[model samples]
Target: MTPSVPSSSRRARRRTAAVGVLVAAAVTAAFALTLDDSAHRDDTPDPSAVVTGSAAPPPADDSLLALARRDPSDALAVGRADAPVVMIEYSDFQCPFCRQFAQNTEPELLRSYVDRGVLRIEWRNFPVFGEESEQAALAGWAAGQQGRFWEFHDVAYGEPRERNAGEFSEEKLTGMAREAGITDIGRFQADMASDKARSAVREDQEEGFRLGVTSTPAFLINGRPVLGAQPVATFTEAVETAAKAAKAAGR
Candidate 1:
């Protein structure tokens, strides 16, 4: 060598090279894991895809199941208070996926599970689309005050419309209420603008946000997360599984 390298210097160089290799290996492994996760997510069915059929397994966090407010008298809910399964729905009035569930899968659940006392349905207004969506949610709550919430819900989701269009204007909402058999339009209007209605909507929105619900038509069946407007079979299976589990747990 041109100059004799100190032994300490040689050892330091070796250590530095070893550390660099370890760092590179760690980074490459981390990247591989990230890519694997992304691939899995990409393979999963898109929630907004046309709901011909799909079923996602329950999420690990069971906190979502606690969303069900099982008050028998709750106007925004239906089915037995002690039903084996409670299905809580987070929905937007202007969401087309919500409409798809309402028009297609919901009726089947009503017939098989709700009517059979195997399931309960609780509705939460989660209007993420904007002003019209919020207005429609408030209108729905107002209709519930007059015992016409379901009727209003049917009218609102009975057909599809352009998002944020004039479909949910104040005048149109009143007409829908009338169609839903709400005789007292005056009281409905008053309730729609009341602090109570706003508070109720805010509470539901907070709950959705807390649970990280970023989309409409999200669901919790006995605390199991069933996202999107999945098919009727998906609901049936969820309901059946939940019912069995509830029975096993003596719930």
Candidate 2:
């Protein structure tokens, strides 16, 4: 017969196991940042197409995929609520690469996949710059309150602007609101300063941080992480492949 282990020894082993599990979880979440920092920059002009390759995305954590709300009434989102493929974008208005994606790639995805009801694009306000970035996020949400979020997005990203400058000041944001066709400037200012807007922006920022996203223009295509402002082909391939997989699995 074998000798029994001491109770104290068993307790220590259990504690070790618990710590190991937590460490593993943190590592898994942080792996993306390791790849992201080495491979991409926020303002790189001719950046690489995809960090993971043009091939099919690897299997992702289910919790990551569930981040997609797909609310049909989500003012900041565009495309079908039940689209098979959802591309969730975590971006900052002050980030040049984010602007590049917004101006160059997003429209193509809208025309090709979103219009066809094969993809949905969800915008997450992930402000990484500073106070100006946070205020801009709040401003975007305020525009959404008036059903002009995309219009505001277009105006904000219409041109490349310096980060942390006066580009996103309260007055500048108000001017952008008017440009985006917000009828009530008074209400827009009120909404932008409201607690609800701050909460909304905070919620989005927390989600990005939880995923270990350390930069602007990060994306999740059907739970698969796609870092940086990749080319339109990269987005196209991701969308199509995810669509096919969803169809095969009867999603």
Candidate 3:
């Protein structure tokens, strides 16, 4: 006859098993949720794929939704913190597709959803390009320290520039900060170089890596993974569907 396991030991083992299950699910979801390799490499590809989360309601304990911070004071976020739908954007500062989404689809979403308090948009700095990308991410966060993140974001994504070029040089970033209305240039520069800023950017980047994101402009809308710079209509439909689901479920 075998000895019975202690209750505490059994609970710990059960918890470990649960964590393992979630980890496996997240890894599988990441692969199933990413964009095509071609899209990541090019400026064009219609790059939209509605995966498992789109067609059906997400699980109540959606691991993807867990990624949403929903912090009201978050400078990189817009819309109501408790909005029925949340869109967590993972993007790189240097990616053309990211610029495409920012320039084209994002404005419309802001008008139709964010401004209307139906959706919340949280930004994740998932810089995958290289050193310049990292620097830009740090700059964006520094600007946010003074309530100028969106301003900086708009300026950075306003026009296309060659990747890894001098476009994101320190001097240029400082000029951009001034343009974005960050009053204290000294503080902004200091913040950009701070360990806090590096840690913040690193945290966002690691989150993206954990999700197996291999490209820019990825998103999780209400826990439904919508990869790449999808069309405005795709985002619109996703938001509307999520809002309706949230209401029906009394969320």
Candidate 4:
């Protein structure tokens, strides 16, 4: 039998893994902090390149990847083909706060908008860490190709450090798709590896940069940008504002 790592050692490993993601996610987030912290990177030139290895996602150093690697369900959906409003998320897997939002916050939004038919949700991958983050996003996208984007996205952030762990691995994503009820895994895998899917992920990141989204959980509602893990009220207000604007435009 394998001995469990000491709690302290395990925590140390998680914190160490989290460090690289913090730097990458913080690259855009520093602006929201004090002036000293605000000295971080902003306005990236090309987001797709970053997510695709120009910068690469971070390595598996934390538990978020482990959490993300678990088999995900096929309960979530991306984009609002039927929604009057669109909500886009700029996210990184290793960010603990994103995980919290996924667990505590997103559920409410789903009950209200995602299910209520008021809005559409779009998952935009912004892997800032290095290879691990990118790997995780790719896995989730693969799940999306299998028509399980939300299930994969939901479970991913729940992971404390499974950025590129077992289930989240490229090869393992197919199994996750099957678990998520996907019947055509081969087709899904092919789609995920296609340039169109890659372009979709990249376009999202590029648009996020254009909209000043430098952090995980930033939202673009009906074409407007809202940054950070804002409160539910903030999201409500933004949605209402966008809705009202769209209504006035007769859209």
Candidate 5:
């Protein structure tokens, strides 16, 4: 004996199933949006950011490697123009991780690789911390006008300060320029306020955005992306690996 189910009961079950499916879809969509936002948010500091060890393969992007300007007279670059390895750094002066890298890892790279002409390091201003960050970057460029960019960089990242706490005021930047031995404070100020400085900073920021760099202290070692303030060894390894690869490619 077969008993037929009521049409109303069948319709009710179908409606409930449809609602469940819609809820599941909504939940999935929301989760995906969250992941997207977290990955691209510029202001959020990622705590888990660290040097990706040898286990993680380096990302490949020949275009990203081509971002190096390699100008011989470029004040923001150090090392040989045709070095086998070029490390392009996207950094913010006010970023804590950037400061960490500047204070800790960069000097080692300079001593071990840059001074030996095994690597070239290019600095790009990707200020995402706000007005003070932009001002500091401009100040750095201004110092570069007098061949004192690295000096200013050392002074700015010499100590840790509260982010955007007026540490980079116009007067402070002027003081830093003087500390970097700009010799001509007037010219430094003029350069800092010039349209050229702003344009230069904007270009760097745009390049970082284009490359999907939403965090400070991001780097491209021969086009391999290295995020966060990685340890000195991590940088050295990347540079060495890239140099080897470049040699093999006859680049």
Candidate 6:
């Protein structure tokens, strides 16, 4: 499945090529009377052709989070030792829809949960594409090394989809990291080549397969799974349920 288009790119920059015309006919030798007729032609394509497919069913996000914590070396989970709940997200950087989900739907989540320190968000890097994808995920994790993971992920996904070939070249990756406020660029580059970064990509892909997450932007809140670029309301409900469950378990 294609990544969700980011709200900014889709809503602001998309262009329409339709034309508008105005015509007038004059009648008279010295001073002619005028007739006015204006018409606009409609050629917009039907949305139903692409929009008719059955929506992919939503999965449980809580169970999925639990399933992801199996490997102690998972990239994002290592540092968040005291969080009440962990959030595991399977994401691709090139997906436009993933960009949309990050830019629009994720703000409220970050503000209330992550910023408040109630939930820890861990990024899992599963690159669906070839080199560009894998490289992008690695660079993103490298950005995380300098405390810029969220910034890099959010910004990269929103950038124009790169040329597929050579998209994740070292120059490109470092450039993107620099743009996302990652200082100490030398360390970031080294991290990209280390076993740490490559393992993150491979492990994410493996866990995704085991959990049937065959697509980008799959999410695991607590131990359950929610796939695709879902609405914000969906995530809110899942998080609330997870919090309640944790509370009940402690009791």
| TM-score (all chains, Cα) for each model | 0.78, 0.82, 0.86, 0.61, 0.78, 0.68
Per-residue alpha-carbon lDDT of candidate 4 for residues 71-164, written as tens digits (9 for 90 to 100): 2231224435645566766787665556656776678888887777677666678776566666666667767765677766655654455443
Model 4 vs. true fold: TM: 0.61
Candidate 3, 1-251: lDDT as tens digits: 99987799899999988986886476546535535565566533343432222233233334556678999999999899999899989888888888888888999999999999999999999998899899999999999999999999999988777888788999999999999999999999999999999999999988777766667777878777677666788889898988998899887
Worst 10 residues of 6 by lDDT: 21-30
TM-score ranking from best to worst? 3, 2, 5, 1, 6, 4
Give the distance in Å from residue 47's predicted Cα in candidate 4 to where it truly belongs.
28
Which structure among the candidates has the greatest TM-score? 3
**Ten consecutive residues with minimal summed lDDT in candidate 5?**
27-36
Q: lDDT, candidate 2, residue 105?
A: 89
Error of 3 at 141 (Å): 0.3
In model 1, the worst 10-residue window by lDDT is 31-40
lDDT tens digits by residue: candidate 1, 133-228: 999999999999999999999999887667777889999999999999999999999999999999999999987776666666777787666776
Candidate 6 global Cα RMSD: 20.8
Give a tens-digit lDDT track for model 6, residues 1-251.
99986786555444321111110010011011111111001112121211111333343333234453533444454334456667777777765445656776777888877677667667788777567788888888888778788667766866555546565688878888888898899999999889988886788787666555555566677765565556677778877777777777771
Which pairs of residues collide in model 3?
Answer: none
- Candidate number that wins on TM-score, 4 or 6: 6
Every model's Cα RMSD, please? 13.0, 5.5, 3.7, 19.6, 13.3, 20.8
All candidates' lDDT scores? 0.78, 0.82, 0.82, 0.57, 0.79, 0.61
- What total of clashing residue pairs does each candidate reach? 1, 0, 0, 21, 0, 15
Any runs in candidate 2 off by more than 4 Å, and if so which? 1-31, 35-57, 61-63
| Candidate 5: regions farther than 4 A off | 1-57
